[model samples]
Target: MNDNHSSSAWSTYSRTVFIAFAMIALGLIANEHRVHVLGILPWLLILACPLMHLFMHHGHGGHSGHSGHDHASHQAGPVQPKKEADDV
Candidate 1:
């Protein structure tokens, strides 16, 4: 049982070390290509707008169901002046 516990601890330690190394490598690579990344940042933002719009509205069913959305239904015919009690 003690040996098994040690092996598990070692496994966890190795995994953590591997992740640390991978992050360091990725960071270095990203630093080297930062200029290229910045160059494409604007295009990425533009592309994300439409992609986000499509995905964000997907849950509530797109604009097709909103065809009846108009101010006409909300307006109670022409407004009439209120009659004064004194006039009555």
Candidate 2:
């Protein structure tokens, strides 16, 4: 039982050490690539605009599927309110 406990403790300790080293390595890599990443940030943002518009409009059923709206009906005349008897 003690041996099993020791093995489990060793595994957890090794895993912790590995994760710490991995984080340090990632930090170093990110620091090294910071300039390149920043240079691409603008292009990434520009690309994101069309992607966001496509995805966001998809969630709202898009512009092509307007079921009840009639475009031609709105073109005929300016809307005038009915004259009430009290107004005259």
Candidate 3:
């Protein structure tokens, strides 16, 4: 393992880590100011709902309703052999 190569590889991620921490700090600060934040909460919720709907539920939304498997004709119970006593 080369020391310089490992350092250079990880150095590329330094900015991403910094940005992630900055966003977390900003969220914490926003959380501290709940009175002001509450006013914007409604709009954020409205905006987030559709974004979540579109992004999170894409698995169900994008696919055609038909998967290859048929559901209706699936057997639910065990098949019992005709009992000898039932015919009477």
- Superposed by TM-score, candidate 1 places the C-alpha of residue 23 at a distance from the truth, in angstroms, of 1.5
Q: In model 1, state the lDDT of residue 2.
A: 61
TM-scores for all predictions: 0.50, 0.60, 0.31
Question: Clashes in model 2: which pairs?
Answer: none
User: In order, what lDDT does every prediction score?
Assistant: 0.80, 0.80, 0.74
> What is candidate 3's lDDT per residue for 2-86, written digit by digit as tens?
6555546456578799899999999999889978879898999999988998789755422556466444434346667886776
Flag the better candidate by TM-score, 1 or 3.
Answer: 1
| Residue 1 accuracy (lDDT) in model 3 | 58
10 residues in a row with least lDDT, candidate 3: 66-75
| lDDT for model 1 | 0.80
Indicate which candidate wins on TM-score. 2
Over 4 Å off in model 3, which ranges? 1-32, 61-88
| RMSD (Å) of each candidate, 1 decimal | 7.1, 7.8, 8.8
